[model samples]
Target: MHFHGTEVRQQALTLLRGGSENAEVARRLNVPLGTISYWKHVDRAKRGEPVATRPSLLCPLCHRRPLDDSAYAYLLGLYLGDGHISHYAKHHVPSLAITLDDGWPGIQDQAETALRAVFPHNATCRVRTKGAHNIKVYFKHLPCLFPQHGPGKKHDRKIALEPWQQEIVDAHPWDFVRGLIHSDGCRITNWTTRLVRGERKRYEYPRYFFTNKSDDIRELFTDTLDKLGITWTHCTRNGNPFNISVARKASVALMDTHIGPKY
Candidate 1:
């Protein structure tokens, strides 16, 4: 009597609790000799059950799982490419192995505990359900993605730019200079909406990119430095717009403050 996948799984589990030996379970269930062994661990548990049923595994950031480390690293690359952390957690699920929100309180607790280890000091860390047997933990800021404290102040600071002010900079004579201070460099200069009292607070993120070779780039860099704003810089060698000098400036901007608005 050949058993199907579902029957084999049930019999193997029954054998586990019934104290049946692997061979005995195989013989009694009339499955392959290695069937029990294979199915025994096929499922990775999010809580108490196995993870194989879902088939698709994804990370908490992107709603896809890696078939291998190469795939995982590819997802991480997308994360570095301007992917918002909150959006990642909100959308992605890790490996489908078992998310924190699998409706298993114990599993959710375990996942939360793991995240807490990474974000020991972050109070806003929490988990949400992604899909069947999938859960993702949400972390708001990019700098807080990893467990350890990042480069600068915890608080995300903002620069007040008038609507026309950014345009004026965008029209700068030098292409390099324009690139440096243009809207491209400033990702979040404007707010989604105005911040009013007794309502939710708004955060603004502004970044600048520069290269060292061009005179205009250098001038833009220096001018940005004089303004004392949050920025990250990368060089041709690094391939990031915010290079070492810009990082130093960015670090300075975040000094002496925790992230987010002060209560």
Candidate 2:
């Protein structure tokens, strides 16, 4: 008798548990109906749960599985900066979506790559809008990876990472910083003419600015910067410290090394 691999079986179980009908799951996964039914039976028996089953093996939060270090770190930063985890009515699985500027196709590719790396079994896609692209993927366990998903907007709620997430960011700090910079931050050069010994010379300043409304999110960004030995300051916007600026030459050099521009 031919049998599906364990990964395929686990994927089928997840789809079946996510309110998908037997025939739909079978068709979507290209698995035989009889095999799908058998997998469901075994999963139900093992879990001792009703129709709705627990998260499949892909959920690191539920299964204590190890995540792709660089991918998770980068995705976490993007999530806190500009990404959103959308909730829906019952029976509809949640989605993790990160909005990227269309001008930077490279960043879009990176976001898609990170999504695929994080959820190798799930499908990733991109939706184009007026001036940007939303790279998203549907997964029932998105909330398991990003615990910060909540009822209100990210800026309106407190954003904090779980211990395990923090560990990944600590390990791959550069990737995390790159994600944040590519999302809500930017690198620009400001030039001013200065008087030299003979003729006027143009003086230029290169700096990075990360803007986010949530205090907790800003703190998280700064905390990561401190660990990386990067200096930053609170750049006041509308009379409030809403933007984190890394303008020091040494720190800016370090940031340029890891994350130049959005491109």
- Number of the predicted model whose TM-score against the real structure is largest: 2
lDDT of 1 by residue, 1-263 (tens): 45477766876777856667778887887777676766666532523764443322223334332223222222222222212232345344311112222333543453344334433433333434353233233433323222222233222322222333333333332322222322123221333555588677776543334333334335444554455454444455456443423334354345212121111
Cα RMSD (angstroms) for every candidate in the order listed: 18.6, 8.0
Cα lDDT tens digits, model 2, 1-263, are 56679898889989988988888889988899988987888888889866543433358777666678899899888888879888777638888889888889999999999998888878899998889999999998888888899988888877788888888888999998888888889998977898899899999999899988888988888999999999999888678678999999999999988889877
After superposing candidate 1 on the true structure, give the runs of residues whose Cα lies further than 4 Å from its correct spot: 1-52, 57-67, 87-263
Runs of candidate 2 with Cα error greater than 4 angstroms are: 1-57, 198-200, 237-240
Best by lDDT: 2
- Quantify all predictions' global Cα lDDT against the true fold: 0.38, 0.86
Error of 2 at 261 (Å): 1.2
- Model 1 accuracy (lDDT, Cα): 0.38
